[model samples]
Target: MQDYRNESEQFDRIVSIGMFEHVGHKNYREYMNVANRCLKDDGLFLLHTIGKT
Candidate 1:
């Protein structure tokens, strides 16, 4: 897998809208780890995904 971390500058805030569902459970931790790596200390990460009834 490619390392996307070095491709961008650290962010103070990261937002994911309607994207987590595509990540699935198996890779959620990895997703978060990448998000964490992309974020700066004291940064904020927000995730908005649809819920099943």
Candidate 2:
């Protein structure tokens, strides 16, 4: 399959609900990088993750 990261279009909004945890710490930077690249200058990015104490 083709890599999606190479896609040219940017999104106006990106939402990550219950998915951030799966990205892990090691890949967080890379994940954010992709998110940044995928988002338009005026776009919005939302992240929702569970927290435990």
Candidate 3:
């Protein structure tokens, strides 16, 4: 996944919805790296997560 993101830089905007909870804390950095790499300079990134009481 890292390699793909590193090479592709192909997204101008990223919208990830409802996918956060599955990513454990140990893999958060990996998730961030993918987002950071996929985003174009000055591009927009949106993330939506749900919370439970």
Candidate 4:
């Protein structure tokens, strides 16, 4: 997954399944930036994760 955002190419759809919870709260922006860089201008992003329970 670390290798994904480094690519110059962008994707039409990006799905981050069960990974968002791993990153700490303070790093959310950075993590989202990676996704933004990987996604295209007209792309779709789906961040699926379970909340505190």
Top of the candidates by TM-score: 4
Rate residue 50 of model 2 by lDDT. Answer: 89
User: How large an RMSD does model 4 have?
Assistant: 2.0
lDDT string, candidate 3, 1-52, tens digits = 3443345555888887877667766877887788888788989989888878
Off by over 4 Å in 3: 1-7
Residue runs of model 2 more than 4 Å from their true location after superposition: 1-8
Candidate closer to the true structure by lDDT (higher is better), 1 or 4: 4
Taking every candidate in turn, the Cα RMSD to the unseen true structure, in Å, is: 3.3, 2.5, 3.3, 2.0
**Candidate 4 local distance difference test against the native:** 0.84
TM-score of 3: 0.72
Prediction 3 global C-alpha lDDT = 0.75
What digit string (tens of lDDT, one per residue) describes model 1 on residues 1-53?
A: 55543436789999989878987889889888889888999999998999797
Q: Return the lDDT, model 1, position 19.
A: 78
Models 1 onward score TM values of: 0.75, 0.78, 0.72, 0.79
Question: In model 2, what lDDT does residue 30 have?
Answer: 79
Ranking by lDDT: 4, 2, 1, 3
lDDT of 4 at 40: 95
The positional error of residue 1 in candidate 3, measured at the CA in angstroms, is: 12
Clashing pairs in 2: none
Model 4 regions more than 4 Å off? 1-8
Best lDDT among the predictions, by candidate number: 4
